[model samples]
Target: MSIPKRVAERITNRIKQFQSILDAQRARDVSEADTVTLVKDLLSEVFGYDKYAELTSEHSIRGTYCDLAVKIESKLALLIEVKAIGTELRDQHIKQAIDYAANEGCEWVVLTNAVEWRMYHVLFRKPIDKQELAQLNLLTIDTKQDECMERLYLLTREGFVKSALAEYRDRKEATSRFMLAAILLHSGPVQTALRREVRRVSEMLVDPAEIDKILRDEVIKRECIEGEQADAAARRVQRSAEKSIRRASEECEGSEANPNPSESPPVQDAH
Candidate 1:
C-alpha cells in the first residue's frame, strides 16, 4: 500500500477502534487531561514522533504544564492544549498556546478537546511581535465523520501545513500593501483631490488615443497634452488671484489718499 493509503487506513482503523470507548465515556465521568493524553499518545504513535513528544504536568520557565510539546531537530515545533469533550474552546485556550509558542519560539500551536482539533500558525514579525495567523479545524469526531476526518488528515499532512504557512505570510504582505496604499491615497482632501484629478486626466488621455490607433502611437502625445492643459489651468488661476489682489491693494491706497467724507472717523471717548 502507498504511504497515503496506509496513513488513511491507519487513521480510519484508529478512529473505529476508539469509537466505542469514546461513546462509552460520553456519559461516564472522565477527566479532560486523560482524554488529552489518549489523543497525544495516538498522534505520537501514528506520526512517529514518540521520541520528541512530551506531556507536561508541572510549571516550567516556558509555561505552566503545556498539555504536549513536540521538538524537531532541537527546535520546538509544536505545542498542544487539551480540553474536555464538552469544554468550549475559547480565546483563552488559544492565547495560552500562543504564549507557549512565543516562549518556546515554536511555529505551530494546536488546541484540542480530543474530539476536535484546531491548528494555528505562529506568525512572528520580530522577536517580540508574535501572533497566530490562520487556524484550521482538524476533526469533528462528534459531528461529521468521513468529511471531518479527511480534513483532519489533510491538516496533519506535511504539504498542507507548508502551504497554509506560505499563504499566511502572503496574506500578511498583501494586507500591508493595501493599508499603505490607503494611507497614501487618502492622506488629506487636497491630496485625495490631486490623485483623483491625475487619475481622471490619465484615463481620459490614454483611452481615446489607444482606441483610435492600432499601436497607440499618439498615447504619449495625448498624455503630454493633458498635462500641459492642467499646468495652464493652474497658471491661469494663479494669474487671476494675483490680479485680484493687486486691484484690491490699489483701491486701498486710493481710499487712504482720498478718504470718504460720508464715512466719519469716530472721536475718542473718555473712559
Candidate 2:
C-alpha cells in the first residue's frame, strides 16, 4: 500500500486499540515530559527513526534544550516539543521551537501532545528573527484519526521536506529576479548604480516595454490566426452544403421528367 493509505490504516487501527487508554490517560492527567517520551517512541517505532534522541535540559545560547531532536546525515532535520493532552498549544510553544531551530539550524519543528501534533517550518531572517513559516495540525490522534495521520505522514516524508525547501529557494530566486528586473526598468540614481554594478559582472539589459509589446502581439496574432481558421472551415462547410442542394434539385427535376409511377421524390441531402 502507498504511504498515505498505510498511514490511514495505522491511524484507524491505533485509534480503535487505544481510544479507551487515551481517554483514561486524559482523565488521569499525564505530564508533558511523559507524553514526550511516548511521542519519541512512536516516532522511532512507527516512523522508523532509530537514531532519534531527547536533548539534554541544558540551556544553550539560543534557549533551553528541545524535547526531541533527530539527526540525519549529520544534519538536524527534526525538532519536537511535547505538551500535556489538555494543554493548549500557544505562541510560547512556537517560540521554543523557533529557538531550537535557530540553535540547531533545522528545517522542521513539531509541537504536540499524544493527541495533537503541530508541524512548522522554521523561517530565518537576516538579523535572526526566528519564526515559523507555516503550521499544520497533523493529528488529534484520537478524534480525527485518518486525516490527521495521513497529513502527519506527508510532513514526515522526504519529498514533502524537499518541496518546502524548494519553495524557500524559489522565493529567494523570485526576489532576485524581481530586483534585477526593477533595476533594468528604472532610470533613477539607485537604478543607475545597480545597472553599473550588474553590468560589471554581466552584459544583459532589461526592456519592460519591449516585453509587454511582445506578449501583447503574440496574443493578438494567435487570436487572429484562430479566427481565420474558423472562418475558412465555415466557408468550406457552406460550399459543401450548396453543392449537395444543387445535386438534389437536379436529381428531383430528372425524376419528375421521367415520372416513375411507383417512386416518390428523392429527399435532399443536408450536408
Candidate 3:
C-alpha cells in the first residue's frame, strides 16, 4: 500500500475484523443501523478518524442528509452515502451522493454498505460525472493483499490527511490518457512510436495513411478526444499525419522511379 508501518498494521487488523463480521452474519440479521455502526467503526478503527472531531453522522446538506461526512483540519474532505446491509449498491446510489456533494461543493465521496466500498471523484465539468476511483468488498480480500490494501489506504484518515487519494486519482487519470493516446489515431506521440516499431519488426513498410486507416477501423474504437481533452493531442496528431503523408508521397515517387527487381531490375535479365 506504500503506507508507513503503523498504517499497514491497522489495515491488517481491519481486514481480519471485517472478515469476522461477515462470517458472523451467517445467522444474524444485519439491519441498516448495524451497517451504519460498522461504517463508523471502520472510520475510527481502520481509517483513524477521530470519532468526535472528524466523523459526522446523518450530515445534513440543505435538508438532504447523507450518512456521514468527514472533516479534516476544519475543512470538509469527504462525504459518505450509506446503503443498508445486504443492499446492492448501484449507480443511483452514487449519483445521489455525488449530487449531495455538488451541493456542498465537495469533490470526493464514498458510497458503501457494510460490506462494499466504492470511492468516486466527482467531476463537476459541464454535467457532473462520477468517475470511480476504486471499489472493493471487505468480505473478499486477504489481509495482506498489497493491491487491495493500497486501494483501501485511499480512504484512510492518514491517507486523506496527506491527500493520497487525490494524487492517486490524478496519476491514474494521466496514465489512462497516455494509454488512450498511444493507441488512438489522433495521438502524435504514439503515431511516431508506432511507425518506428512497425519498421523495426517487419519487412513491409506502411505509410501513416494506412496506419490511420487501420487504427480507425481495426484498433481504436473508443473516442479518445472529447471536449476539452482533444486540445491536448489534436495539434500534434495533425502534424504527425501531415508529415507521414509527405514521407509516404516521397517513398511512392522513389519506388516508381527505381522499380522493384521483380518488375524491372536495371536490365540484369538481358545479361
Candidate 4:
C-alpha cells in the first residue's frame, strides 16, 4: 500500500528521532513503567494516536490491564504490551497480550520494549493462537529504507484507518509456505498439472497418487505439510475450491434454465 507523502515523511522523522531516545533509554535501563510511558509517547508522536484520548492504560480484561490499548473513535484498535527497555521480548509477553485481545474479541496486539516492536494477529481458537505479522527494531533498521518505513507505517494511525495491517495479515497467510505446501499437496488441479508435466518431461506416465507421494515424501518439507498451520491452510484451500465449484455449478444451471430470450418460438404463427 502506498502511504501518503505526509505520513511517510512523519514516519521517517519519528524513526530517526526515536532511535536517539531508544538509545538513551537502553543505556539508562529504564523500568517497565518508564518503557510504557515511552511507548505511549511513541504511539502519539510516531503512530499518530492521541495520547489522552486514543491511547489508554486502563483497558482491563479478566482483572488484568494491558500496558496500552489504542482506541480510535472509542473502538479498540489494538492492544500493546510493553517490556523494559533492557528486557528481551518473549513468548510470555505475547501470551499476556493475546489473552487481553481474546477476552475483548480483538484481533490485533503489539509487543514492544520501546525499541523493538512486534505486531501479532490473535486467533481466538480452542486454544488462542497468534501470528506475528511484523517485527522491527528502531535502533537496528535503516530509517530511510522503504521496506522498513512501510513496516512501521502499518502501525500508524493511517494504517489502522485503512486496515492495512489486516490486509498485510491476509497477504502473509495466502502466500505462506504452509499454505503453498498445502495447495501443492491437496489441490486436485495442482496434482493433475504436476502429473501432466511429469509425463511430458520424462516420456512416462505417472499416476497422480505417485506424484503426491513423491512430492510429500521427497520434494516438500515435512514440517510444512504436517502441522496445525498446515492443516489450517489446507482447510482454507479446500473451502476456496468448494466455493468455486459451487459458483460454477450455479452459473451452469442458470444458463440452462434461462434460454435466449431473443429467440422467438413459432413467431411465424402470428403472421
At residue 86, candidate 4 shows an lDDT of 100
- Model 1 lDDT vs. the true structure? 0.55
Ranking by lDDT: 4, 3, 2, 1
lDDT of 3 by residue, 23-44 (tens): 5652375777777787888889
What is the model-wide C-alpha lDDT for candidate 4?
Answer: 0.89
Candidate 2, 108-216: lDDT as tens digits: 7777776666666665665445333334432334425443444545444342444543464345433443333332333244445755665667676645455435534
Superposed model 4: Cα runs more than 4 Å off = 264-271
Assess the local accuracy of residue 3 in candidate 2 as a C-alpha lDDT between 0 and 100: 47
lDDT of 3 at 151: 87
Q: Which ten residues in a row have the lowest lDDT in candidate 2?
A: 178-187
Extract clashing residue pairs from model 1. Answer: none
The local distance difference test score of each candidate is 0.55, 0.55, 0.79, 0.89
Q: How high is the lDDT of residue 216 in model 2? A: 40
Maximum-lDDT candidate: 4
Between candidates 1 and 3, the one scoring higher on lDDT is 3
Residue 60 local lDDT, model 1: 51
TM-score for all predictions?
Answer: 0.49, 0.48, 0.78, 0.94
